[model samples]
Target chain A: MTGTGSISDIEPRLGYSLRVNGRDHEVDGAWVGDSLLRVLRDRLGLSGSKNACEQGECGSCSVRLDGRLVCSCLVLAATAVGREITTIEGIAPEDGLTDVQDAMVTEGAVQCGFCTPGLVMAIHDLLDRNPAPTALETREAISGNLCRCTGYGRIFAAVDSTVASRRDAAS
Target chain B: MSVAIPETLEEALQVAAADPEVQVLAGGTDLMVEVNFGYRRPASVCALHRIAELHAQRQDDGEVVIGAMTTYHDMERGVIAAALPGLAQAGRTVGSPQIRNAGTVGGNLATASPAGDTLPVLMALDSTVVVASVAGRREVPISDFLVGPKRNALGPGELIVEVRVPHLRGPQEFLKVGARNAMVIAVCSLALVVDLERRRVACALGSVGPTVLRAFEAEERAAQEIDWQTGRLGDPAFAPEFGRLVAAAARPIDDHRSTAGYRRHAIGVLAERALRRSA
Candidate 1:
C-alpha cells in the first residue's frame, strides 16, 4: 500500500489518511497543493496549530512528524500520508496544561498567545531531547519560535522553571 | 494535480523520466515556500524523501558517500558531522532546528542558490555530486554541478543520489556574515579546507558570485605559505594576502541583502577570519 488510502471519488487530486494525535483520519477533497497546516486545521479540524506565516519563517505552524519538529506550512498534506503527526492539541494532557504549558502560564510567557502553541511544542521537544538544557541551549532550541509579546524574557524563565520542577519531581 | 511518493530510487527516476516537468520535493524548505506564495503551481510533484536509498550514507576507502536525502539535522551531529566538520558547521547555520530536520542536502544542491550554506563547504571538500536517471548514473564535480545562481546541471530525468567527499585530514573552517546569527541567509561566506595529506589548501567563497567560486590564487598562495607538518601558515601576513586574492575572485552584485562592494569586503574579511580560525 502506498498508504495514501484512497483517492477522492469526486475529485482527482485528493484523499489520504494521516495518523494524527494517535488517530487515523481520512482526509478527503484537500487540494494537492494544500499544506499540512491547512489540512490539519481545515480538514481535520485541529485548529490548535496556528497559521501565521504560510512560509516556514514563522513557527506558528510547527508540528511533530514522527517526533521531529517541522513547520507544517512547509509540509505537503498528501506527502504526509502514513506519517505520525502530533500537534499542540495532542500535546496537552486530558485535563490540564502540561508542565511546560503550566510553566508558561505561571511565568507570563504568553502575551498575545499566537506564538504560544509553537513555543510550547518547541519547548517540549527541547526538554525531551535534553532534560537539562542550559540557558543558551534552551534559547538556541527555540530560536526558530519567535514571540513578539513578553520580549522572550518570560519565555526563558518559563523554560528554566520547567527544567527545575522536572528535576525536583525526579528527585 | 498528482503526487508520486516513490519508494525506490528506480521508481523515482521512472516517475521523473515519464514526466520531466514533475516538481521534486525533498525537504520542502525552498520549494514549499514557492508553493505557499503561489509562485509555482506544480501540476505534479515527485516526493523523494520516502526512498530509503536516498537517505543512506557510508564510508568507503578514503571518502564519505552521503545520500542526497540526508537532512541538515543529520549533518548537525554524529558520524557525518565528525567526518565533515565544515559541512556540519555550514549545516548548523541553516534556518532552524525545524528547518534542519526537514531540509535535505540534495535540496540545497538542487536549488543551487548562491547563498546555499552547504555549497562552499562541498566545493572546498573537493566533493562530487552523483546524479542518476533511468539510463545510468554520472558523477559531476561540485564546481560543474553548480552551474550558476539558483541553477544546476541536473538533466530532465536526473536526480542527485549522493555526494562523495574526502574525509577531513586536517583543520577546516566555514564562516559567513549574516544579518543575524540564526535563521538568516548569508550575505557572504567562506569555506577553508586544509588537506594535510595532500599538502594543499582550498577555499571557496559563497553569496559573492553567481556560483560558489574557488579562490584559486588564494589556494595556490596559501598552499605554499603553510607548513603542512604543523598545519600553520609560514608567514602571518599570508592570511590577509590570501583574503585579498579571494575577494578579487568574486563577482558580487548589489542585491537587497548586501551591496556588491560590501560583499567583496565582507568576503575578504571572512576569508582572513576563516584562515586564522583554522590556524
Candidate 2:
C-alpha cells in the first residue's frame, strides 16, 4: 500500500476560528478537510493565493502561515487553529502595493503572471528573514519556486533594488 | 478523514500500540507523497509530530542516542554532526530545506528503503535501531532490521523509537551520485567511517542493493591487508577484491532509472572511494 490509509476516512467538523489576512474570521461552514488555500480564496475572498500544485511542489499556493512561508494548498484549514495567515492580500497595509510588489512591476519581474503571486509571497518571506541577501542568496532562497517566464535576471534585479531601497530607508 | 493528532509521546505511543492497523506519520515527506499519489491507503493514522519527548538527543556511555523525532536540521547543527559525521553528511543531502526540516531519522529507518540517504551512513556507523511496542522495547542492529527493499523486521504495533550510533572513531565522510544536487534521490550513495587510531574502516552503500548494505568484507580487507602506514589501500589485489565484495553484495535490479551494470559500476566506485577515504 502507498500510505497507511486515505484522508477521506478522517474528516473533522469545521468550526475552527482562523485569523486570516489580519482579520479574525470563523470558518463556520467550511469542512474540516478544506485546504487553507481554498478557504483563503473562497471564504475569505483572498484570491491572490493560487493553487497550481496542492502537493507543495508548484509553490503557487504559497502563503505565510503565522509568518512562516508554507504551501497553503497543502495545509489543512483545521491546522490554522488560531494562527495568523498572511496571503498576498495582507502584504500591504491599505497603502496600495508594497515596495516589493512595486519593484516586481517596475523591474518587469512579472512574466506570464501565473507564478507572480507565489514569487511575491516567497520573496516577501525571504526579505523578512534577511533584509539584505546577496544575489546568490536571493537565488537560493527562491529555488523552491519555479518560474517559467523572465529568465529571473530582472526578477533578481527587482528584489535587489527593493532590498537596496529598504536598506536606505532603514538608514 | 483527518488523522488524530496526539499531543503527548505516551499518548501517541499508546494510540499506535493499541491500534493494530494504524500507520504512523512523522514529517510525512515520504508517506504523504505515497498516499497522495495513490501508493498506499491507510485506514487509521497516528501523527507523531507533536509529541514533545521524541525530539531529543543525548550521549550516554559513549553512544549517541538520537531521538526518533529529531529533524535533519537538528542533526546538522551540533554534536550529532560530530558523533555521526557520515550521517550528518547524508542528512545534508536529503531533499531541500523544507523536506529536511520535516524529515527525521526515525522515519528514515521505519521506511527501510534501499535509497534512504541516512541508511548507508547508519550502516557504516554500525547504528542500532530501537523499536518500541506495547510489549516493551527492543534494540536491533541496522543489519538485522533491514530485511529487503521497502521491508524491515519491525512487527505490527512496533515503531522505531530511536537510533543509537556509537561515537565515531575518527572523522567520517559521505558522498552520493544523483541526477542533480538539490532534492535528488540517490542513484548510488555511500558513507565511510574511518578509525584512524584503531586502523579500522567501515563502508556502506545505498541504492545498489535490495536494502542499504555494508561492505563488511571490504572493510576487513582494508584492516588486514591494506596499508594504513602509507595512508593508502596497500594491495591492488584488495581493490579488485573489495570491488568484487561490494558488487557481490548488490541486490540491485534493472529499472528505468538505472541499469544493473551501471549500478554495479557505481557500487564499486563508491566502495573504492569510501574505503580510500576511511584509510
Candidate 3:
C-alpha cells in the first residue's frame, strides 16, 4: 500500500455507494485506491467524462462534486462516497443538451470533441456562478480547460452565445 | 490503502497518533498529483476536509487565525484577503479556479516546495504555524517550520492546525516570475511587506534556494534607508543596492525551469519592483 501499483494490489476489494446523475448507485468490487474518475468511467459506465490527463493540470475530467467543479481524477472514489456527483452526462436533460453544450454545438466549438465535455462543464459552472461574465472573465473561467483544437476562438464564441441566449431567456 | 475521513480534530489527531505513517489529506492538490503521476502510494490517508474545526477562522487579539483547511478560493475573498493581501495575491496566482478551489494554505506549507507561491508571503508576513497533537498544541514560526525542500518540522502525529497571520501594518505586495501568466509555477517569486507600526520592511524570496529565504541584509537596509512616513527610499541608488543584496541572499541552482543566473536576476528585478509598488 505504500508503493504505486494497480488499485487491486494496494488493498482488498470493497464496495462504495455513490449518487451520480440524480440516481443512486452502489459500486461493488472497487479498488480502494481507485480515483473517482476511474470508478465513473469504468464501474459506473459514465464515459461522458474523459480521462485525458489523470493529473489535475488538464481539466478533461472536470465534474461537479457537491455542486462545486473539481478534477475528478484527483478525488479518491472512497472519499466521494455519499457525495453528489454531476458529470457531463448528468448536466443536460435525458433528451436534450445544456445551454452551454448547445452553444458549443452551434458555434462549432467542437473540433476533436475530447475537450468539449470539460469545457462545457467549466462554462456551465462559470455561468452558474457568474451569469454575465465579460470576455476576459470567460477566458479566465476556462483557463484550466485546454483546447488543443479550434484555437479557442470558437470556444469564446460559444461562451458569448450562451451568455446572450441566457440574457434573452431572462428577458 | 484506506482513507480515514475524520469529522473532528481530535479524531484526526487520534488517528494520526495511532498510525504515524498516515498521510494527511487537506485539499489533495499536491498529494493527488503525486498519486496520479505514480510518484507515491501512501499506505493510508487521513482525509481532513470534513473536519469543521480545521475550516474555522477567527480574529483573536491582533492576529487572524485561519484554519488549516482554508482553501485558496477562501483566501481570494472575504476577510482573509483583507488580513494578508500578499498571501491572497499569491493564492490568486496559484493554478486556476479549479486548483484554487481545492488547494489549501496548510497543504501548500506541508508540501514545502521551494516553488510554493504562498511560502514567501508566509515568510514575509512573519506568520506562525500552529500544530496540534493528542499531547497538546505548539506554534512554530514560518521560518522554522519549513526545514528544506519538500520537508517540514511536523513531528509524528502532529498536524498543522491553523496559521496565525498578524494584521497588516501597511501595504504589502507579491510578485512572481513564471513561464506563463496562468496555471504556472513560479520560476522565482518575491514578497515585500511594509510594517509602519514597527518602522521596518521585510522581504522574502521563493524558488531560489532549498527553502523560502528572507533577504535579511536587504530587509535591514530597506528598513533603515526608507522613510517610514513616505514608504520610499530617499535616494534612488538604494533601490538597486537593495535589489543586489536580495539577489546576493539567494542560492539558486540551474534547473529545467530556469537558470541560476536568471533566477538571481529575476529576484533582483522583482525586489526593486516590489519596493516601488509598496512605496
Candidate 4:
C-alpha cells in the first residue's frame, strides 16, 4: 500500500457510507480505488465473502448489491455508497442455517469450502429468481461459481435436495 | 484518486470536459478487471451508473435506441431481445449472470476488444454509435467506430451515449467459438444479418481480425446467390464458397487461445452455419 507519489498522494481518502447486511457503517479510510470485496473483508470484518479471483471471471466473491447478484471484487466500494449489500453472512437467520446451507451440508456439497459462501449466495439468488429450477437451470445458475475441488456433482445434488425440500414444505 | 458519480449525463460530460484524463466507468466489467489485476491505475474515474439518461431505452420508428449503459442482463430479456435477437444471443454468451448484470453494451464497445461478442452483431446489423461531449453529439457507424483491437473512434472527453440499430425484416444469427461454454473469450465469431426488403445479406467476423470485419465479397455473393422470395440459397455449392470467401477476408494472427489457421477455418464454419441458420 505504498503511495508512489502518484495522483493518490494529491487526493485525500474519502468517506463512504454503506448499508451491509441491514447494518449501516461509514468507511472513513476507504480509498477511492478500493473494491467492495476489500471493504467487506478488511474494513467491515465480513470475511464470509471469499476473494478467490479479483477479476470478474471467478464468482467466489459474489454478493447482492441493490438485489442484483454481482462479483463484489468487480464493484468499486466508492460506487457502493448508499446501496444495500447482502453478503453470505446475511443469508441465514441468527439461530440457524439457511435452506441452501442446510442442503449443502446434507448433500456433502462443500469440499475445501473455499467456494461455499459464493455458491450459497448464488444458489440463494437462483432459487429466489426461479423457485422450481430444473436440473439444467440449477447448473446454469451456479455456472459462475467455480469449485476447483471438482465437487459439481454434490453441488447439483444439494440444489436438487433444496428444491425438493422446499416443495415438500410448500405442500 | 477520486470517483465522480454524475447523476446526469450533462454533469458527466462536464466532468469529462474538465478532466480529459478521467476514465469513464460504466459497468466496470472490463475496467475494474484491469484495476484489480493492477493493469490500470487511473487518476480519476467518472462512473455513469447514476446518470439515468445512459440507462434508458426507447423505440423510434423501426430503430431501437439502446442507452450505452444498459446492462447485458436487460438486453437479453427486454425489448432489446425482440428488436435484435442476434445481439441478445451475443449478450447471453457474455460471462455469467453476475457479469451480465454488470457488463454493459457501452463498455463493450468502448473496450473494442477483438473478441468482443457484441461487436460482430452490431456490425452485421449496421448499428450506429452515438457519442457526446461538451462540443456536441455525433453518430458513427459501428464499422467506423471500432478502429482496431482495444481502440475506438472516441475523442478526448467524448462518451458514448447510445447505440442505434435498425429493425430489419429478416432473421439474424450470431455464433461464437470459445474454449468453454461460459465466461470464455471467443476464439472467433461470426454474425449474419439478412434484409429481405432490400434483398441484402451481410456477415461480420469477430476475433479473426484486428477489428470486427465485414465479409464484403461473401455478403455480395450470398446476396446474389440466395433467392430473396424464399429466403434460401439457390445453389447449395454457394454456401461453402461463401464461407471460404468470408474466411479469406479475415486477417487473423496466431495467439494463445487459437492459431491463425484454426481461426480462419473456424470463421468459415461459423459463417456458413450463420448463413444457413438465417436462411
The alpha-carbon lDDT assigned to residue B114 of candidate 3 equals: 98
Give the lDDT ranking, best first.
1, 4, 3, 2
TM-score, candidate number 3: 0.96
Candidate 1's TM-score reads: 0.96
* DockQ of each candidate relative to the true complex: 0.58, 0.26, 0.60, 0.69
Relative to the unseen true structure, what is the C-alpha lDDT of residue B46 in candidate 4, on a scale of 0 to 100?
92
lDDT string for model 4 (A1-171, tens) is 476787656565879789999999889876677889999999999999998889887799999999999999999888887789999999899989999999999989988999999999999999999999988888778888999985599999888899899999999
TM-score, one value per model: 0.96, 0.83, 0.96, 0.97
Candidate 1 segments exceeding 4 Å error: A1-12
Would you give me the overall lDDT of model 3?
0.89
TM-score for the A-chain in each candidate structure:
0.92, 0.87, 0.93, 0.93
Share of native interface contacts recovered by each model: 0.66, 0.07, 0.46, 0.63
Alpha-carbon shift of residue B25 in model 4 (angstroms): 0.6
- Say which prediction, candidate 1 or candidate 2, comes out ahead on TM-score: 1
The TM-score leader among the candidates is 4
Candidate 2's C-alpha runs over 4 A off are A1-47, A53-55, A63-90, A95-100, A124-139, B225-248, B275-278
Off by over 4 Å in 3: A1-10
lDDT of 3 by residue, A19-102 (tens): 998898989987656788999999999998899878777798999988888889888877887779999999898799988999
Worst 10 residues of 1 chain A by lDDT: A3-12
lDDT of each: 0.91, 0.77, 0.89, 0.90
